[model samples]
Target: MTSESQTAGTRVLHLSSAQLARVSRALDGDEAAAAEFDSALSSDPVRLLVEVLSTKSVPAGSGVSYGHTFVTQHPTVLARVAIGYGHGLPRKAGNRAWVTWSAAGGPAVRLPIVGRVAMDEFVVDVGRTPVEPGQLMCVFGDSDEGEVPLGDWAAAIGESPVSVIACLDRRVTRSVVE
Candidate 1:
């Protein structure tokens, strides 16, 4: 609904239920469903903050591009994350892309990708987090206290705020907490 400037160099873009509905229609084409989904995500206090990590090391001879690249080494922790380009994650996010994140009781962290990001899957370092399937990932939203933000990631990727919100699929679970 309103845009505010933060001291941390990130701009907070607020969206109301009505504004989010418009974006949902543009992305999903079902106004009713979109409205419902938007209502769920908007009402939540915990925001999404996607952190990309590298899964493998690219060889020196190999040049990693957008969607094509191979892991020349082993022991790669390929991050099977829930967020991807289809969810408004940036397509330009190549291998070794950086994202800021923080766990339930840990400090904010930064991680990188090891391989090319597929349509639905992208990798991350996950240095800690003890990641497992369905471990609650914040791909793009606000943070605890609405302080640490993911808005910079959207701007850096040249993605419109509306498009980012639309990218989030209805399948992703949403929860609200005070």
Candidate 2:
């Protein structure tokens, strides 16, 4: 009843192997248990939604964002998206990371984050695709839908998968969709 030795699931990090085994046993179940567990952890529900501010056309040689770290190789559309380092987005991801956006009634497309990330915003090269202001841009979410996976976001910041999910600041609005 008191002391017993057991092994735990490898996914749990805080517990010793024996203690983990005990927890694993307690949480373990049969067919129904497996189904429940799979359903619970199958996908991440959180998505960082950055509102699109504006869009414009820049010449092929135009410098993008701050410092001209990225220059458009061709005339393209640049979109400024709200939410940046101040909102828990990693500034290091600037000019390195990318996001997913779809023009009105258009297919989802991957857009590169260009130039330096500012305290309040970042830029994306959307290429001739027309985008409107106030449209929401997905910074990280379901990859099946062409959005950037959480792993990629974590990788951009030199961190693990869980760290990116934990980086959301209070500035990000949360709404329950039922």
Query: Which candidate comes out best when scored by TM-score?
Result: 2
| Estimated TM-score for each candidate | 0.52, 0.70
lDDT of 1 by residue, 38-107 (tens): 4454344225543233233333444333444644343334455645565445666655345545557766
What RMSD value applies to candidate 2? 13.7
Model 1: per-residue Cα lDDT at residue 93:
60
Q: How well does candidate 2 score on lDDT at residue 116? A: 85
Question: How high a TM-score does candidate 2 get?
Answer: 0.70
**lDDT: worst 10-residue window of model 1:** 2-11
Alpha-carbon deviation at 32 in model 2, angstroms: 24
Check candidate 2 and list the clashing pairs: 7-21, 8-20, 8-21
Candidate 1: stretches off by over 4 Å: 1-46, 49-76, 128-133, 143-148, 173-178
| Cα lDDT of model 2 by residue, 30-128, tens digit | 444333322332253334667777889888899876788988898888988876676667887877787887766667788888988876778988887
TM-score of 1: 0.52
For residue 135, give model 1's deviation from the true position in Å.
2.3
